[model samples]
Target: MSADTSSRSSRQDAFDPFLQPELFEGVRSRRIIAFIIDAFVITLLTLGASILVFILGVFTLGLGFLLYAILPVSVALIYAAFTLGGPSASTIGMRAMGLEMRLWYGAKPYPLLAAVHLLLFWFSISLLTPFVLLVSLFSDRKRLLHDLILGTVVINSAYHRAYTREHSAAA
Candidate 1:
């Protein structure tokens, strides 16, 4: 579902997640730290894969440098697409950071939407524009433009699963 921009309802009722403020709170500084840790791990894996490709190229094959250039990007895109669309609904980095991805409906996204989200993320980061990073400053939930475009939200996975369990139990 799209963000509720209707004026007919009270603002508080517009966003379902807002009904439970604690869910949003988990996206704080701690998640950022968890993200950093995940990024480091992904980077290391990318580097190792690159090195292997390079060594293979050295053994009478010219595929090493090619892999060096393509592998990292591929790994990154695949990571983005799968995680954002997958059960966890976040990247490995996001997951490690205790964050998870969610659709506007508070559910997992379809694969196609996830792919688009991943593409937008890379394109935005590649541009390295100050405006992109600054979008969070103006956003109520600190979401980037790419996130807004996809109608995806990143919340703390730890918090989300717990919240889901508790709510389910109550129901």
Candidate 2:
């Protein structure tokens, strides 16, 4: 008898949770929680960077003012890029909050893509003033400006059924 192609494909899809369309539903709340966590982390980083810049400025007799302009943006971009590129696909705060980053239509994005994603996020939020966030409200995927650009999505890891499967497998 010929192989049952439909069942075979279904089985394959089941084996790969990342490819499941339904796995991404209800992503908005997860993204909100993740953003809160990320915001805290960013705040701490910004505070530390500011202190360091202040010290440097004092030591340099005022050249530190120049450093202030770029430090926050630089810190945010570097941290975001590396975190998105890493295995967790999220910053430490996001992990602590049980969230993860994935592509809007597919799997985890590559580091290079994720970095660009982070950059776009920062630029829009920093430059657009208010309109940048409107995309999240109107976009079908509930993506912010950067998410739209990079096709990335942030979801709640705690409630994710896929997490259970992976956790069980690891155990």
lDDT of each: 0.69, 0.70
- Per-residue lDDT of model 2, residues 47-159, tens digit only: 89999999999999999869888887778777777887777787776777666787654366677876688777768878995787677678655667777666677766655
Top-scoring candidate (lDDT) = 2
Prediction 1 global C-alpha lDDT: 0.69
> Model 2 lDDT vs. the true structure?
0.70
Give the per-residue lDDT digits (tens) of candidate 1, residues 28-67: 4654686577578669879888778878989847855776
Give the 10-residue window scoring lowest on summed lDDT in candidate 2.
12-21
- My TM-score estimates for the predictions, one after another, are 0.74, 0.65
Give every collision pair in model 2: 104-151
How close to the true structure is residue 146 of candidate 1, measured as C-alpha lDDT? 86
TM-score of 2: 0.65
